[model samples]
Target: MRRSRFAASVTSLLLATGLALTGAATAQASSTAATGGYVALGDSYSSGVGSGSYISSSGSCDRSTKAFPYLWNAAHSPSSFAFNACSGATTDDVLAGQLGSLNSSTALVSISIGGNDAGFADIMTTCVLSSDSSCVSKINNAKAYVDSTLPGKLDTVYNAISAKAPSARVVVLGYPRFYLLGQSCLGLSDTKRSAINSAADYIDAAIQKRALDHDFVFGDVRSPFSSHEICSGDSWLHSVNWLDIGESYHPTAAGQSGGYLPVFTANAS
Candidate 1:
């Protein structure tokens, strides 16, 4: 059975914004970072939407201390930690709204963008509530968008980031793969799960390419969450939370700590 083949003994799911972990070597941030600014940009993943403990002052942006950015800032105590990422942000949003936090004084930068640009929410909605064919079709359209358009948008963002913070070390993080195929998971079909994973791969690959092209580090979270995907025993992502739809498909606090923090830390220096 396909399930048996891919049967990872994982629990809980870390359905998250497009940021994965790759178990890279640890590099401590230089002391210069202590005096320089650290700006966190991108989307909900960067903002800590799914992890809870939302900072009341963040308003609708839903910034959370549990988010990896905040955690990093706390550990490093940079001169300034600008948390500008918002929920439902796109590349244009980052260009127009978030880049202001970045400047020559900025020393470390991290962002998790492009998923929203590729219609992640719509794709998830389709895969979750629609037929299997519909799910596949949505993924195909997203893949096409990633291939034809996302790179350019990413270039624009990366260029802007570079221009704003020429001296900063930027890290572009990826999302985790949501499911482990062949599990008797109750929600989506195996076909849909696999399709979603493929979509993540496409998105991550595209994001990684742009990051490398810009000379920024790409942080892949897949390895960190590999055994803990949806069907695993300990999931860092939240499945569909009917009560709090906003939190659906987002990483749990553990995900921010375990899956995302390490990758960002390794690349930040």
Candidate 2:
């Protein structure tokens, strides 16, 4: 009877050990399956150009840890993360270089494009350094481009992304107004600031339309940055950084965290 009882004790221990091992394996498999794949593709804003503390391996892409994509991924811990956003990327540049990152396995995709295609940098330079009339003329030219040519370009890029990542939830993020309306700072008049804001609105409208037409999500950042524009006392965007021109007019870390990340996280599924 003593031997029989000892044998039963060992059998119960072995059975418990097997059950624990099986539970562990099942839990690991569930975790793996829950971790979805994510891909980020777009221009400077999406790349975190002004947020600083860039990833050295990203090179000129200027990807920052403070960028919305990285922040989102860190919080969610996706199974696979690909950051292909580059500084100065236009719609065409994305089509040529970035779309390769998207595939059927990509469960989520985020992009911020069309600003460069509108020649925003040039407009800013004109508005900042040149006369008011010069700024107006440059802005008008950009608006013309947005009206005439930008729609087709956006359509092409959106279609390509949808085709490449059929399974992915594509989110196209829009640019924010750089300055508050009728508020002047850094030598910019109300007219110039309004023009810049109008341009931003134009770009956002075009991008939003394209996103909706393609049945993708459009993340509008304008409302989120409404009170944090350049003229705001607590501005989240960087001003003209002569030392680092690339950082100029880009979002600061505060903007990335407070202004951009929340909106992205809300839309990212």
Candidate 3:
């Protein structure tokens, strides 16, 4: 009986030490994965529309391989990535479009939306280039919708993300300047690019406010590209030789790394 009791005590002590060591190792690995890793959300800006990039050939969101998240991941080597950003997605798209890809393991998320919600693309083509006030009215309508409806949609996204990633940090991305404030583009006169940018700013601010409310990180790409506006020399967007053609507005590879990647990293931490 004495021998059996001593053997049992020894076994129990060994088991306890093993469990403690396993737990510590797991914690250390999790901390390492959490440092530079993240999941990406949102629309074209996050997906890299006109940026000529592709993440995978998967028939889902067509996330770009050259998008900011990928760039950030490559630079820092994150443990995992779930990018579900789609071009032309609205705020509702997050729930109906991009939630399944996220999970508890995700360490971060980024998104840019609300442009398609207001038919913003159409407005740019019609109003900014035409003499009608329809574009302005439509823009106003879009802003109102964003201010009112965007929050609820974002709330749903936030809740769903939390359900999946209880420990993940969320980053909401914003649009870049798509048009010149005072400069005219191909066959366009009296452009409302400033107004469009302002509307985008408003949406970005709203997204940021939502982030603060949820204690998530709000990553705005507006100010960073302010000096690199469309039509400006050394523009962050627009390809070489097409000073008038390169989509007039999207982040160059350099811009993505410099302007957006830092925001993602800071918030990811």
Top model number, TM-score = 1
Off by over 4 Å in 3: 1-37, 179-191, 238-248
Mind giving the per-residue lDDT tens digits that candidate 3 earns over 96-207? Answer: 8687767766676777666666565555544534454665676788788877887887787788888977877677776666555665445333435556666677777777
Go through the candidates in order and give the C-alpha RMSD of each one to the true structure: 7.6, 20.5, 20.1
| lDDT measured at residue 126 in model 3 versus the true structure, 0 to 100 | 48
- Output the number of the lDDT-best candidate: 1
Clashes of 2: 0
Model 2 CA deviation exceeding 4 Å by range: 1-35
Name the candidate, 1 or 3, with the larger TM-score value: 1
lDDT of 1 at 71: 84
- What lDDT would each prediction earn against the true structure? 0.82, 0.78, 0.61
Superposition error at 22 for model 1 (Å): 15
lDDT over C-alpha atoms for residue 141 of model 1: 98
Model 1, position 189, has a per-residue lDDT of 90
User: What would the C-alpha RMSD of candidate 1 be, to one decimal place?
Assistant: 7.6
- Minimal lDDT window, size 10, model 3: 19-28
Kindly list the per-residue Cα lDDT of model 2 for residues 93-201, writing each as its tens digit.
9999998877888788899998888887778767766688898899999989999999999999988988988878888899899997656566578888888888889
lDDT of 2: 0.78
Clashes of each: 22, 0, 4
- Number of the candidate with higher TM-score, 1 or 2: 1
Candidate 3 global TM-score:
0.76
CA error at residue 215 for candidate 3, angstroms: 1.1
